[model samples]
Target: MTLLTVTGLTKSYAGADGELPVLAGIDLDIHEGEIVALLGKSGSGKSTLLRCLAGLIPPSSGTITYRGRPFKGANPGTTMVFQTFALLPWLTVQQNVEVGLETRGLPAAARREAALTAIDLIGLDGFESAYPKELSGGMRQRVGFARALVVEPDILLMDEPFSALDVLTAENLRGELLELWDSGTFPTKAIVVVTHNIEEAVLMADRVIVLGGRPYGSIRAAYDIPLTRPRDRDVPEFSKLIDTIYRTMTGRADTPHPPHGLRQPAKRTPANTPLPAASVDGLSGLAEILQRHDGHLDFAELTDELSLEVDDLLPLTDALELLGFAAVKGSQITLTDQGLAYSAADVQTSKQIFATAAIEVPLVHFITTSLRNSVDGSLRAGFFRDVLAHHYTSEQVTQQLDAATGWGRYAELYTYDTRHEEYHLDTVPS
Candidate 1:
């Protein structure tokens, strides 16, 4: 039943000071005909673990066995789908799907048929000839998926394949994928997904694997996603599961305030305390930590507070530095006043954390900033789609926003407004 088993897997990279370990003493077992979801913060080694499982990178120490044999490297039947669509620009959809089949060396006619079947299976019946540029974000991702499917891999590896997609498109694709899996088509015997979305994991995966910080991608916890097939997010059980997972990841207490069952007011800290000029700009780890806690937070007390081991905290802390919330002054972490304000601001107590308008601040700020500074008016449409689709990297998002807002480069991209369900532009910079 164990299709893939990894034991004591360790990986490291050379750093300025020493060998920086990225993954350490990791252990995992994936069964046949199951989907395993890997959850973590952005740089929590989810991608590295996925690469290791796919044999894209060899671990420094450990044994990986697939179906009881050593997993030395990528096999003919193992396929991966990356967050970026990674399609050939010049190739049509059909051609891109067929590209994987080149190694099979089947006759042209046979290959064409196989490619067509894959395209259809992924719901791209009429899009076979469209180029990557012409296809929408969702459609292009499907083409990447079709490419993976054509190879008939035993295990499919997905590194946030839907993360770049807009919510509606991503939801639609998730539904279609589940239907395909249910129907026993598409060729993958098992699947493993690396994702930051807990709801997606709960809905799609049979098992959820939580990866904790860097120096080693260690398992913080593994929970069986007990919801039945065709789960509905509107249901109470579904909401409960999401809430639990969120609490587990961020070391937050279950139900910060008593009995807010489904809906609760957003928590905003009183503007007291001297607000320090941010050591750096942008959302910090404090934001992530506070979001995990549903906005009721304690600084200094919560750092290194995760259930995951000490080795798993470094990269997370390092990333916090980029967000301007985490600073190391001689082995001590000091949270800037901005970090505290952002973390303690109007966050709703709803079970659906992501569904709240407060959740839209960062995203809206990101989008608005881009639109304000764009040189070409036409690029706005594509750029908007990219944000909705979730295709671009954080760097890409910031770059576009910076480019769009050429006037005031230091505009505060987000703010809390109770009347608006999402962050509204405080004032369009004149």
Candidate 2:
């Protein structure tokens, strides 16, 4: 049975220029007896979708029905577990767990009994009287779980619940939760988790939904997990699924192909193809590694060797691809001839190559050209920010500018004066 139904959901936030769309034309259903994971890169609207389902924020357009009834306000049938372990610092664990019950107007004695039961269920029985400050990170998160579970809602919504915890602690908590879930003693009938960790999603979700696109707020694909309970990460099927998800996330339909020993410059505008948040050093390091590996490596193996999550590596890979220094095709990244030379070249030689490549990037090109066109070969930083504001949020505009600044400085294309808030074309020959 479907516990929650969402159709044609669209959410937008008021921005400086106009309304910025987040989730667009999203259709989803949360069924009973299932754990659904919403997986995506940052800004993919995973948390926004969760908030819409929880009725914490109203969708700009769409219908959300809980058990066939449209949500009028906050959905009483769902409770949230936050990443930050949002426990009241002054409140004892017991009081924190009782908060939802108190709001529901349950009698004090009944609320206390329910809170204790939840605390015991989550393995925090002894910590009930302790304050959040007295507990470790894991212990505090356990309290967060108990607090959410004490409400006994039909569905539990988790927003990166394990992201802030230590790896071992997160693994232990995940195992305990799964054990409880398998035992059929879990308080919620359905679980919805929003996470960027592909392995974590594969481990816990019965179904995984991938979200992507500009602003990364649209559903791109979905897969049903067929693995049985107590999954083993070492299994071939597990690794295969991870690879498939990686390809999906990085795959671009319009990826350019080099021809005649020259890289094809992207025709996209800066707004459409925003620079990936990666540093010159990071992408350069990855290129050197690829060169050492004979210009190719399995994506998953590379991630394992670096001890980095997929999210950590994606930005670097994206930057490499954007600069025409590397190519990714279905779980394998191969360094191009240019990439090999860039890795082997001396600092000055590499800068010349990078400068040529960077100009092909729309944002970098826009900056260089704008500075060159100016009468004094200089322009205020606000000019670029104002141009980008139509397409990105204020925070996003800052990030884009930062990425461009790093690339421009490394390529000797332009220089930004922090004190004067200006960009000068002193390095580039007119």
Candidate 3:
């Protein structure tokens, strides 16, 4: 009972100077009543595949068949919910939901009935007449869902629809969607959700598809979600699964940045001048400085205090600085107050991003947030290491976290005493 089948799908677009392929030789089958998770990085053609399957974009050379027939462009049997809620502001909730039915040119009474049913199904029973402006982020997203469902599509295509909602609201909607899907009362024979969240994929998808490779996205791996429905996150198996998906998605078995005891050379700045504030350009020199110093060193000792080379820092320093989490001045390159704030925010933001990816289990994002908020010292390091340990060594976590926080001061305080092979967090004496 295959609801949709896409074969020989390929897509390419002209770039600034030449044609670039986004998807190549992708073949996928979505079965009846099954949820399929499509996982990939930002530009990895996950969305392109979804758009092609939904007929939003025509493939360069491919055929998309819906229920054993060639899918005509934007047919009623298929509906899509975009990451951005596509509700018409001028329209009331009821009107927005009804738009799906209007395309069918159904009679007025039939359209109204279908719209009301969708509204109820999505838990908007009392607010049928409210406008998009009158709803919360979650409710607005529900309107998008209701609209998609009203058409009674055989297959539903969702492109990270919950990515925008708050966590509580997203979780609620997820529950609702699952309830409806489990009840088997709606016409939805299958669903295809595209996400960057590995946990989201594992939780909802019966089968998880990882789009890997370069030039054109290829299937890196396809895993079956064997966990029982409504799985617990605290379980060991769950954590293991999360770790596995994360490694696959990032295209590495272990963590990308490992901590070496080597400290970067310090970036020199004025003794009293507050660092000009950290930017992505200076993060690498700052990192190398910290490594050279073996952790914490005063700004005056840095070799390149006045002028620092910036090109050597790629992805690492760039990501840290561009995100506004570190800074440098004449004698001292230190973490700006904002940098500290970002470290805290990054923990939660990363969690949210990971949660949206649709993986059943949560790993990196989960551990980062977990350690940031915990009160116990060893628990902080232990739990932190527990999650990060699989992909990175304790030293690596310490180094990356150190660079990220511009907490070279903290890094020096805590170093692994290999004699005991235990991490010791040193509290600086005021």
Candidate 4:
């Protein structure tokens, strides 16, 4: 049965100057008896869409319907589990689970039974009275699950819930949830989970939807996970799916930044673009790893070895390419002479060589030139902000500036004073 339907969904935020569209022309549907995983990088609209589905926020344009009725507020019989445990510290596990019941004016006796049942279902029966602070991270999350399940929600929305847990714990929790879900012990009709982990998405969901790049994104692709429950991650098909997503998300290594997905603006990350957060050290580390395999490591091999998602891997590679250290083509990474050299260089030599390449970036050059020409060799960082605002969204501009700042700071091309938001020439020689 169709549980929820979204049509022509568009959402925007009012920026200082105008409406900044986060999601546009998005249409989606959720059905009964399926777990849907929303996957994307940091800026993608997965969370925003989740919020919209939960009715926590209204879409700027579009309609979301629940059971064929227009959804105006929080969807009935729905609850959310957050990435953070979000358990009230003062409330014991049972009390925490009972809070929702209390809000519904359920009698004390009924609330206790419902909360206890949920607690036992979530394996927290023994910890019924344990405070959140006294519990391990995993147990605290179990309390979060118990609290949500106590309401017997029709649809459960999970926002990176397992991201905060340790690897083993998360795996264990996943196993437990699947076991209960498959055995008819858990009763939720449907679920939506937001995650960055590719393996996790493929392992748990009936469908995996890519939210794509932002400040513009929505339902770029939906992949069906046809594998059976308790899918083997080491199986060829599973491993192939992981690599396919990596390539799809990151694009051909030879392709420039923002290589694939929703947007197709430019071949390279233009000077005005906000580079995703990455570092010279990270670039070197990837380069070193690639070099160890003779600079011909395929995308799948590299990601498996490093355990990096497309979002985590692509930006770092973009930074390296932007700085002339590497070249990416298809699924392979080839180190430039500079990349190999940087990998082998002593600390000082690496930074010095990097300084020369870093200055070649247009934004970095602009900062250095502007600071060099200033009366006191300084310029307000806001001045750079003005330049970026014209080219990108306000939030993206901030990210761009951060990337620019990190590059400048490392190269000693300029110094940034966070307290004053000023970019001044570094007095220390490079």
TM-score of each: 0.64, 0.78, 0.61, 0.78
Q: What lDDT, from 0 to 1, does candidate 3 have? A: 0.61
For model 3 the TM-score comes to 0.61
Which run of 10 residues does model 1 get worst, by summed lDDT? Answer: 268-277
lDDT per residue for candidate 4 within 107-163, as digits (tens), equals 999999999999999888789878998999999998888888889988999989998
| Candidate 1 error regions (>4 Å) | 252-430
Clashing pairs in 4: 253-328, 253-329, 253-330, 254-328, 254-329, 274-400
Global local distance difference test of model 2: 0.87
Q: Give the per-residue Cα lDDT of candidate 2 at 390.
A: 73
Evaluation by TM-score, superior candidate among 1 and 3:
1
**Reference-based lDDT, residue 276, model 3:** 20
Candidate 1 on 120-214: residue-level lDDT in tens?
A: 88989999888999989999999999999887888999999998999899999989999999888758899999888777888999999987652
Steric overlap count per candidate: 16, 0, 40, 6
Q: Give the top-scoring candidate (lDDT).
A: 2
